[model samples]
Structure formats: C-alpha cells, structure tokens
Target: MQTESNGKRKRPKKKGSRFMRNAKGFAKQGIFGRGTHIDDDQFSYFINILDAMKAGFEDVEDRVNMANNVFEQTVDKEIHLSSNQIVSKAIESLIGFVDDAQLERFFGKFGDNLRPMCSDRFASHVLQKMLEIAFLRGLGQAAAQEQSEADAPGPAKRAKPDAAQVEEQYNLETDFSDKHREQCRNFVLRISKFMLNNLEDFVWDSCATHIMRSAILCLVGIHVPKIAFEKGGAELAKHRKLYTVPEEWHEVMKEFPQRLELWPQFVDFPYQEHSSALLGVICLSLSVVDKSMLKHFGKKILTQSLLKPNEDNGDDDDEKKESKIEIDDDNDDQGNNEKQDDNEKTEKPNSEPAVLLPKVFHYQCAVILLETLLSVAGAKLLTQLYAMLFSGRVAHLSQQQQTNFAVQRLLQHIKEVSDFESVFTELQPQTEQLLKMGYTGVVSALSGACLRLGAKQAQMIAALQSALHVTGDKEKSKLFFNCLVKLKPHELLAGDQSGFVHLHGSLIAQHILQFNKPIFLVNCILELPAEQLSQIFNTPNGSHIVDAFLQSKYIGEKSRERLIRQLDGFYVDLAITRHGSRVLDQCFKAAQEAQKLHIAKELSNKANMLKGSPFGRLIYTKYRLDTYKLSASQWQASLGQQQQKEESVGQTNKRPAKTATELFKDILTQ
Candidate 1:
C-alpha cells in the first residue's frame, strides 16, 4: 500500500511540474528581482512564455495568473523592481493576445500598474510602451471596422447607434479605443490626469519627483500639438508643430480642453519650492492652449493683485486719523482720555498680517504671465501689458527692486521676441523717475537691456548720458561710470572734440581711473589730441587719472612713452603740488630708460630746490630710492663710511698748526 501511494504522488507532481517551476522561478528571480541588470537567458525565457500564451498554449490561464501576480507584487513595492524591461516585453506580447472582449479589462489592469510606476525611470518606459501599443491596436481596429462597413451590403443595413449609446460605448472601452486618434487622445489624457493628480506628491517627495517631472514633460510633449490643433484648427498645425497629431479627430478634442483647464492653476501656484519645474509645465501647456485664453485670465488676476493697494496706502489713512485725533484733543476737556483713545486706534494688534506673499513673487508671476502672453497672444498683448506696467496704475504697488526685476524680465522677452527698439523708446520717458528714486540698479538693468536690444551705440550712450546728468550723488556717479565702462562708450568719451571733457570731464577722469579696463581708457587718453590731453593732465582730478594710468599694470610701452612725453615740461611744476606730485612719481616709475634718464637729470639739477619744498622732496626721494635701487638706510650708511674715510685721510696728513690769532694777541699784549 505504501509503494502504491508513493507511485501515485510522484505521477501527480510530475504532470505539470516543469512549466510550473519555470513560471515560479521567473516571477521570483527575473520579475521581482532587486537589480535591473537582467541576463539574456532569463529575459528570453519570459518572452518565450508570453509568446506561447499568445499562440494559445494549453497553460495560457496559468501564465496569465502568473503575470497578474508579478504585476501586483511589483506595484506593492514603494521602489521599482528590476523587471521593467521584462514586464514591458511581457505586456507587449500579451497585447497581441488581447481581443476586443478583453481589451478594456487588460488596459484597466495595465493602467493600474502604470500609475504607481510613472515616477520610476525604467518603469515609465514600460508605461510609454503600453500607450504606443494601445494606440496602434486602436488604429488597426478602427480601420478594419471602417473597411467592413464599406464592403457590407446596403439592402439590410443595420440601424446606427444613437449618440447616447455611442457615448456609453466610448466610456466602456475608454481605457482602450476603437477610434484611431481618439484612442491616442484617451491614452494621453489618462496619463495627464494621473500626472496632475499626483503632481503635488511628486513635487514634495524626494524619491522620484525628477523622473515624474520628466515623464510629465514627455507626455505633454506628445499631446500638446493635438491640443493646439483642437483650438487652432488645421491652419495652426502647419507652422512648426513639435508633435504629430491627427487632424481628423473631433470627439477627443471635446473633452481634452476641459481636462487641460487645470493648467493655469499649476502656472499660478503660489509656492516657489519647485518653481522651475512648474514653469516648464506652464510653458508646455501654453504651447497647446490658446494664448488668448491664458492672457485673458492672467490680465484679470494681475490687475487685481498688482494694482491692489499696499500697506503704504494704509499708513496714509492712519496719518489722516491721527490729525483728526489731534483736533479732537485740542477741542475736548478730557485730553488724557482722548489721547488714550488715539493711542489705541493707532496701535494695531500683534497678529501677523493676513497677506504674507512676497512682492518679488507677485512681480515674477507678472513676468511669467507676460511671457506666456507674448508667446501665445502675439506682440499686441505684450505691448498692452508693457503699457500697463509703466502706466502708473500699478506702479505704486511694486517696490523699486520689484519694478526693476520685472522690467528686466520683460525686456529680456522683448529682446528675444519683438522689436526692442520700440519697447526701449517707450521706456526712455521713465528714466527720470528711475533716477529720482536713486534706483541705480534699475539704471544698470536698463543699460544692460538696451545693450541686448541691439540698440544703436549712439542711443545707448545717450541713455547713459541722460542718467549721468541727473545724478550728482557720488555713489550714483560711480554706478553710471560703471555702466559707461561696461558699455564701452568709448566714442562718447574719446577724441579731441568730445564734449565729455567740457561737460563732466573731472568726473569722467575720476571714473576712468577707477574703471576695470583702465588700459582701454588710458589708450583713449593717449590718442586724445594734445590740447585735451594737456587739459586733462593739468586738472587735479585729471592728474589722478594720469597717476592711475601710469601706475596700472595694463599700461603698455607705447602708452607709457606717450604719457612720459606729455609730461616732459610739466614734471617740475607737477612735482611742486600735492596731487601732481603723485602723478609725477608714478610717471617716474613708468617712464622708459631714456625717459627715466631725462627725468633723473632734470631732478638732479633741481635737487636743492626740490629739498626745500615738501611735495618736491617726496618726488626727489622716491626717484632716488627707485631709480638708484637703494634704500634710505643703505645710502646713509655709505655716506657715514665716506665721511669716516675722509676723516682718517685728513688725520693721516695732519700737522701741528700755529694759530695766527694767538700770535697777534701776544703782539698786542707786548
């Protein structure tokens, strides 16, 4: 009986043991494995099983059950399994096996698995494959049905389904499709919805947000042209379409617009935590949606927020109330009581302000919205927006810095997309207000913006000159000089006939000395006509410029030679004054060998005169130390040694000398 029972058990276990063991091993080692590096043998084994199932093998049900188990296990894990390629291959093969009757069920399961895996890089690849396959299958089926209807006899035509029934059927197989392009639309919309719903999750979660954002961008990239087409029609499709979308489909277009309406919310999300990623989504959406729609919405919101009164306005009201209280105090007998009431009215509670949004954020939103408008609504809307920004309607709402930032961003867009000359010309009138506010930053930004606008060099120089003429503040003067130097307005400052010397010559000279490219300015000075160069060197501030140029490492041999020649006759006179002495000393160091010899000869002749003057003595001593390459102590030591040697020689030759005075006195006394 024991042998009989053993034989029976062995036969039962051996019946389907080979297939079952292979399936189990694939599910464990290949499908739910830890690493992504799958060997070819394991991958082939899984593909072969899928192919067998498609070929209607007897154990098809068993393989299907195993696939379901594999998908479930993969989805339950928070992190991705190494089975993306293996699972994608399995699904690709399985898609061929699925018929119309089971299409919806298959896709329902597929989408469920895809939702959790969208954030995974490799898993997202599998999801993309699912979408492409579904699209192709739907297209093939639609073509077949159309051909069948065309070939069928017309005598006994079947009644067409009503719109309600058609809608129901669409809903039933929404995950899959019978219409070619509608199916593609459904696939993209499904993924978009999934991405939108989980957008906050992906943004906040550090684990997989990068892959999620990439996937979102990819999905939007594929579907944007379709959305653009639905709104823009066929004419809009011909111009630089990034994606290929079908022109025939109108049914999916009906639902797609409503689905994408959530885009503006993402665009206007107040949190700046993941702003760059969010801006990408906004830009992508704007590519498809009608720019007029976003513009209309943006203008309304921007007007409300940007034109809203700020705390400064509230301060004005408080001041009015305080003045009224002072009048009451003067008229009433209860002065102390009235004062207490006034104090209570003026002192606000320590509660936090209701609105905490940063002014910069509001400005950034305005800029991004304006850019979106420009890209979508054309240049007309951009002009209107620009006018609004500078029209003084919302000007008080923005801080100076905020206004500067907004202007920079707006100008950047204009420079890229439109004729910047018109925009810059419009902004020219505001230069006075920008300067009056001491907003040198805005001035610099404007200068930079004008440069980018490809404005004429003369126009840019004129703008900078206007900015300089209005500001007497030392700090603003420095800022304007920096702007001029950066713009390299050499034509405006150089040449013998240039009015810079007559207008702001000392200021220009001082700035040129402090300029980053002192060599460029020095060369400009060297090329100046003899009269202008003389005038520059003669002024106190201009002498400083010459001093700075002579001391600069950037000064070349030719420039030094020219400068030394210019200073030939002025050296003695310059060395006698305080500021000029500094210039003369620097020139002494910078002068060439021939020039140095000339200067040294001149100074030696006037050594006694130089020693008597304070500023002259500084030039003489510096020349001696630098030209002779001797320190003061070394020269003094040498003098002492010479004196000692002379004394020794005198003593060696010494003899007892008779005093003539003593002999004369002795004669007088006798």
Candidate 2:
C-alpha cells in the first residue's frame, strides 16, 4: 500500500502488495553512529583523507587510499566507522562513489572482520550498504536465482538464494562476469554466516536490528529495494516495504527474541518497540505465500513472543546478556570530528520508570505487531491470544495513546458473536471517554465491529446518539451523519467553501451505511436537505458515502429513487467539481431511465455552468446533455437504445443458467 509519489501519473504498483501476509511495512532507514577515533594513523593517512572526504573532497585515488587506510585501522586498532561520524561518512563515500576493482577490493576486505562491525550503530549501516552493493553489482546472479525459484508456491518458495530479489525485468547479465558475481557472492556468504551466528545479538540490539533485517533480506533472497542502496550511512530513513519472505527466514527466526524474556526490559529500554516492529516486518515479509511457514511463524514466533504466561509466577523468564560492542572510550570528538555531527549518542543509562504500566503503554511498536498478529494468527492461536491479550483489555487499551492502535486492530478482528459481546460489553461504557479523548479510530472500529458481527446494533445506535448528544429530530435526521462525519451543523445547513472532508467522520459514516440493516442510516442520509446532500456529493470521501447509499443492497428501489429525486435540483451542484462530478456520473449509472432523463434535463438547464469545470465538461460529454439541448425526444430515444444494448451485452456475457430438467438429470445421474 506504500506508493511512490506518482504525481498524477499512473504509478507502477509494486506487485508485492498483492500477496497475502502480515509484514505490511518496511524499515524506515539505516541505523547510524559515528566511527570510533583512530590512533592518528590508517592512522595518519586515513585521518587526513577521511577528513578531506567528510569536508567534501572528491578524488578516486584519495578514496582508494581512504578505503585501504580505514580497513587497516579497522583490522589493526579495532577502530570502526560506526563510532566516528567522519569515518562512517567517508567510508560510505568510498563504498558508494568509488567504483571498479578498488570498490570490490574495498568491500572484500570486510568479510572476515564484518562480525564485529555488525554490532555497532553506524557501522551496521556499512554492512547493510555493502550487501545492497553486492546484490546490485551481482544483478545477474540475483536475477537467475529468482527465475529458478519462481515456481515455488509453498514454504520452499521462500528459500530462494540470498539477495535473489531484483526488479523483475532488469537485464543485468553483462554487468559483471559470472566469476566476479560468484566472488562477490562468496563475500556475501561469509558476512551472512557471521550475522547469522550473532542473530541473537542483532535481534535485541536497537542499533543492530536494521542490519539484521537487511541480512534477512539477503539470506531470504528478498530484494533490498534499489532505493535502499541510494541511502548512505548517515541518512537513517525508512525505505520501501519488505514485500515477501522466503522459507529460509524460518531458520533465521528460530531464535526470534522471546516475549517471556522481555517483560522486565519494558521498563528499561522501551525494548518492545524495536522488537515488535521487527516482528511486524518479518510477519509481512513472509507475506503468507508460504502457508506452512505462516503457520509455523504464527505459532512459533508471534504466538510465543506475545502470549502471556500460563502460571501465576510470570517473572521466571531469564534475561539474555546484552551483546553490545564498546565504542572508543575517548569522548573528545575534537578537531574535524565536530563537523561529523554525532547521529547516535553513546549508550548511557536511563533511570527506569517507577511503574512498568506507564512504560508498556508507550509501546507503539507492539501496536503494529499486534495488527500483523491479528491478521495472521491461526484459529487456535487467535483463541489463545483473545483470552490472554485481548479478552478484558479492550476498554483499558482504548484509553492509552499507544495501545489504542492495537485496540483498533483488536476491534477490527472481532468475528465471533461471543467475542463481539465481550468486547462490546467492555467497550460501550467507554464511548463517551473515547469520543472525549478523540479516539475516533477506536470509535470507528467499534461501530464497524458491532455491525459487522451482527451484535448490539441497537446499542451502537444508542451509544452514538448519547455520545453526540442527539436530542432532537433534526439531529437524528439531518445532522446525524454530518456530526458523524464531523461537519459543523452550521456548515451542513449553510456552506462548505473548501471540500476537505474529515476522514474519520467519513469512515464512521461509511461503516454505518455499508453494514447490516442500514435502512435507518439510508433514511438519515436521505433526510438531509438538498444543500447538505449536494455538499456531501461535492467531496471525494463524501461522494463515497452517497455512492454507498445508492449502491447498498439493503436500500430499496423506493429509497434509491427518493435519493435521486432529492438531488434533482443539485445535479449541477454535483457536476462542478472532480469529486462531485463522479457522484453525478454514478447518479446516471445507478438511476432508472426516467431518473437519468430528469438528471440530463437538469444539467441541460445549467449547460454553461455544467461546462465550466473540466470535470463538469467531462460529465456533459458523458451523460449526453448536449443531445438533450439538440432534441429531448432524440436524447430519450438514444438513452433507451443504449440501455437496451447494455442489457443485451450483459446478458450475452453471462454463463447460461442450467434448466430445472438439466439440474434434475445431473442430480439423478450423480
């Protein structure tokens, strides 16, 4: 669902979004910190060149010189780019802009020493960038690896060769010889082994978690998007989504940081944030293409990490030792290092909160993770989670700023009538608090959940009436949906110069009008005076509300006819804007022929104003109002012929229904 800014042009939809899975997100950016200061050597030469490069110097010889010196300092003194900003930037420059054999040699140097670097904040970015470069450079191998694995429809489908994902139609075979590709790949294999060996360390380390995801992409052959390669070490920004995970991820996830062990750290590091977000990425990456893997992931990783303890004594889970790498002890980032603004700070101790409740409430990552879990967990796991995590927590969670997101997800997933009743029982009392708190998403989801599960519809109606203080016939009739969509009562009655619609208000309206037995809701919409109806039809989201009413199966033909007749004088009002014009078109499509004729006559009445907007002009051409201007009788004849042809065409395309005799014969034969 993450789209590039297509800017009014048709955007190429990333095919990855179509997959069925939970990791519907991506890591925003590379983790960063400055490199540790060296002993004025890789020492003397690297210090000078790194400073020069960080100062915007450009020369291949200097970069090659910098790469060699930096690698030497890394090997000899254990100094790293992760701790020093200049060094991280300079190294990023060398790896990125520096090309030819020197670049390969520069990358190849880190294969053995890569394990230590993966533990640092900024240094891990170097690892992520290196992997991106290797795959990009080895595009031939990446493409081939992808082609070979194309037929895998199950768990094995996720086990493609590391870094096999590339833009589908890119032909990069001639970029590098196979021998060179294999060499770069060997280096990648060594790095992968090193990270895989330290998977436990990476999973828990905030700085190293990004490197962990990048490595997962490489290991599972998930394409680290080219835009990721465009990110240098300093820019800690989110990239494109991790579309799908290959099967090998299960092996990688076998040691996913356990929730049983993470409870206490909730008060210390906000550890659950990164861990939960990581799980969300993993859940989405698996993309549910692999049913076996999804089942395994749901059970082994998500269920286990999030589930509560079976026993009363829940504090028994052991904690793992922290595996952080020590940066240079010297705090003097003096000299040119000042220009290297420190992106990551030295890890200092934070005073823990007095209570764990406050700490857990701020866990934003858990919200996303819970959403992924809600979508993918199997029936048994869902029941377990519903009992353990959600059963009584819906009302309490809805009050928090962070956990309310999870509450919304929980509300959206309510299916069973028993579950809906349990949730509704707890949540209905808090509606006033929720409305006061502006937890409209929760309120919106609450309405959807109630109507969707066919539970407590009358109660929902009552709750909304009370929450909005609907004490009058006018409030119930005209302003109910308007207030629900958050339009000011005054604006509904008089004006809306700007077409901006409140999305949450519109969502609440949409859920109401679309769900079971929306006749009363349809009547509320219908009862809106013509000006308000025109205003609703004038905005994009508002138009969807009108379209829903026109298209709702629960709405009778009499109700739909009333809706068309109500908009009788306002066809021009609906025709003047893009959003409104769409409603105008829908009216023509959904209207009976006589209703369509009335609509055409109205547009012809304001022919010049209807022709004013480009969108309105399109409406004019589309509904044949010009034919009405020429001859009303001819326009009616053309409209009749068009409807007849459409009916005939639709009938011709249908699968012929079997006769009763045929059905009887088939049943008897069977």
Best by TM-score: 2
Global local distance difference test of model 1: 0.45
| Model 2 TM | 0.61
202-305: candidate 1 lDDT, tens digit per residue? 55443234434333433433221111001222332232112223432322332332343345553333224344334434443434434454455445434543
Off by over 4 Å in 1: 1-112, 117-190, 196-280, 292-377, 393-403, 414-460, 466-483, 487-670
Q: Quick one: how many clashes does candidate 1 have? A: 0
lDDT by residue (82-182, candidate 2, tens digit) is 44543554455455433346446656555546656667665666666666666545544334332112222345225432222322222233355667666
Q: After superposition, how far is residue 470 of candidate 1 from its true place, in Å?
A: 12
Question: What lDDT score goes with residue 379 in model 1?
Answer: 49
Q: State TM-scores per candidate.
A: 0.33, 0.61
User: What's the distance in Å from true for residue 438, model 1?
Assistant: 12
